[model samples]
Target: MTPKAARRTVRIAMNGVTGRMGYRQHLVRSLLALREEGGLDLGDGTVLWPEPVLVGRREPALRAIAERHGLAHWSTDLDAVLADDTVEIYFDAQVTSARQESLAKAIAAGKHVYTEKPTSTGLSGALELARLARDAGIKHGVVQDKLFLPGLLKLKRLVDGGFFGRILSVRGEFGYWVFEGDWQSAQRPSWNYRAEDGGGIVVDMFPHWEYVLHELFGRVTSVQALATTHVPQRWDEGGKPYDATADDAAYGIFQLEGGAVAQINSSWAVRVHRDELVEFQVDGTEGSAVAGLRTCRAQHRAATPKPVWNPDLPATESFREQWQEVPDNTAFDNGFKAQWELFLRHVALDTPYRWDLLAGARGVQLAELGLRSSAEGRRIEVPEIAL
Candidate 1:
């Protein structure tokens, strides 16, 4: 071994390795990449070196993941991994219902943590986890994958460059039809359909939208929403019909701190007719931009879109064709894998890692407020999160 390569090692213990997110994010994206490529190199021979010492899961699945990732250590005992001196960081991608318990245990064992979004199913649990992490003096972070998307990054640049002057309102359309778990076998896990498992569109996706909204426009102040369950029943892993008790779709309007307005729609059962599944439209005094999943278009006041009631007008010249594709400018990779690299650098090199627990709590806060608004049939003011 090279003298410099043996100097530092950041041991990691990953919890919940059997599930979908666990397999994709932890095993394939994070741990495997770290082991094979030696972690992401920050610069000047400095590298974020990760030593995945323990991966926790059920017995059979744990063994499979160990063999898959070529990991030497595996366990089903959370406490054992936490107690190991070789493990310095604890990562969790468990279901939202179990996130709080796993995180609390990890913190008590005195290890830094990084976990998936919606830190918890509700505001209270999320707040408690944030407090524990702070009191324990351990660095904590949550996955905000949307912030790293190539399309969103380009949009951020436009906003920063004053392309959208004094933004007036923002609109977002996010969703795609998931399987009914019978004929198609359910694209998402069965746990997502169970309210008890913290599975709901609002909780799963609002956290992602929160960061994007805050990043593009500003902080959200008030939210009014309506939530629904389009699919009442879905098949479980065992291929039996189970009644879905969670909201599968949600429509909401948010008032930003700066008086900017945003309308967001999230769904798991909807057919999309757009270029990409997700799209965002931002309007400003000087200009407006329509950002589809893969494309973005800017319109100045001189070129502002016009509307007509007359059916004679020739199909409103396909504006989609007029827009140019925004190029990805950031050097960092995209998606969850990219976030993994950034988090590793943040831990090892003290790089600017602002995606912390408080940001995550903000997401949970929004979800809680949305649910309340829907249930009360009125607009709800979002409470300020105390990080």
Candidate 2:
């Protein structure tokens, strides 16, 4: 006979639900789906149910989204929501500049916090928020969604099993050509190209790279970065031209604490030639592997074919085909939802959650250092941040 499930609802005040990442990822993909699937099973019998109240500045958009998703609650006034006793958790996906202030408010209101990454515009701000959360004695977590990606998980498995011995280096290629919005509709929001609006490839993508590099190989010890604003002017959604003050591309080289070198090129101006929108290649002594969003391929030293340098002769060797595909032996869940479930469990069950504001601060630290490196035109040391 099946056992009965014990369930408890967690009321979460979700701010910035009207934005793109907020709506699609945190709301549609994660919270609503969790609500629809009943609740997460807690290994034993107890289950944690997610109850999200959409909060935003725009009442009409919030009401529409809430009504469409069959949500019972939404509010334009955050103060009123914070004062309510029912809201046990507060989540934010707001712009970088606004994150620290709102999250600080939530912590002061005695609510557990979960937020999207690059927690704040600066390391100090991020660290202050982390310190506040700790001082308030509330559970806190930051989204590190990329670590949960299926491809990265598989790569982690390989690393754990010693598939790649004595890892030498990592090469990450990410991005696609974003249309300048003059002749065609821009794929990304116009705010992404404006520095004043908290836009730039280094600030946007370096945080992700920081975590990925730290988790996969080791923590970054030093960084050398060069940033560029490829498209200086672009048309907005309303067909109005605007100056893009942020850097659209960043070329960075990092020295890992474990002595592994990692080079990453992040851009909105370059066309991709890889298998996915983003890809990472890890070269080691025993084997080499390449991982994308959902696919992973590897070649062991024994399987590697010898190739002689002969540019004069017609190249017949299929270098790409020499590598064998890694098997998908297990199923993977949606990254955003997985992290959400973990955060909910952390709040409800007192689970051990690792990705806290401190980790988020580290992400901000890397972005700060990367920007400094670019501005100074020299390699910058990454000092460990403590809160």
Candidate 3:
């Protein structure tokens, strides 16, 4: 008879459950889902269980979330939770401005930390947090969930297989029209458009671009960007008008290591014309591929179609139909949940996990450089961070 696996319950103090990404992705989809599955099998003699202690500023909201999820633990005080020795891990999904202080507290409490990115509002603060986590000798990580998406996973597979030999360039388009609150209620929080609240497309998205480019291709060597606040006036949640001081749109050109150029446009003012909300097109010597959040398609050099550029005639080529869909060889789980399991294992078993706070600082660094480039109206070289 086979022996039963040992079960270990890990209490994680989760902050910012009131937020959209925190509630939906981290709590419901990831942690709670893991609990429902009877915890994660650690591929050894043990099974790792996740017990969440919901933390936030509002008691009512925290209590409501805890009750809805059949959880007994919820706290309005972060310090109270941090003081508990049983809470081995502290996860932060708070607003960008509030993140650094809370993370510092968690580190001070000797709790392992995992957090959402652009880890801090600025690069210096982010690096400080990273340094603190490193000195504390605690397991730490930042959310880089997009890398685990089905499309990016397939793209990684293609890269690993040398399908796109000598990768030349990458173009990325991301964003959608965020409704103004007056006529139609805003889709995002009002704070997202307020500069005082640490809001901007460059700050929000350049972090994502930084990790994606660095991990898949090479490190970003330089940046040229234009950040703009297209929608100047916007109504808040209370139907009150306010100045939108943050950049709603950002256009950037990044030079990657190995001479690859990447151009990405991120905007909240754009209408969708592509198949997905976000898409990246990569062109190489041997082939080219386009990938979105869930799908990836590739066209080999042999299958490339050529069309004569004649202004007088309408084009006859079905350019969209020419690409072949990349098959999902294996089933994909939710990206947030996947990373959660990995972090849990890293905590329980000391597994190899590389996406730490330092990696997160790199994201913040790119965001800062991108914004600086826009402000200075010139290309800015990315400096390597050491700590």
lDDT of 1 by residue, 1-387 (tens): 743634367888887768887778666776676657866666756666677755555788888777776777888888888888778889988888888888899889988899998898778888899899999988889988777766677788789999888999999999999988777777889888888888999888888878888877899899999999998998987789999999999999999988899999999999987767888988999888878645676777776667666886667677666655666555655377778777877777777877888889999999888988999999999867885
User: How accurate locally is residue 81 in candidate 2, as Cα lDDT from 0 to 100?
Assistant: 97
- Largest lDDT belongs to which candidate? 3
List model 3 lDDT by residue over 27-55, tens digit each. 99999898889889988988888889999
lDDT of 2: 0.91
Q: Relative to the unseen true structure, what is the C-alpha lDDT of residue 53 in candidate 1, on a scale of 0 to 100? A: 57
User: What would you estimate as the lDDT of candidate 3?
Assistant: 0.95
CA-lDDT, candidates in order: 0.82, 0.91, 0.95
Off by over 4 Å in 3: none
Off by over 4 Å in 2: none
Instruction: Predict model 1's lDDT versus the native.
Output: 0.82
By lDDT rank, best first, the candidates go 3, 2, 1
Error of 1 at 51 (Å): 2.2
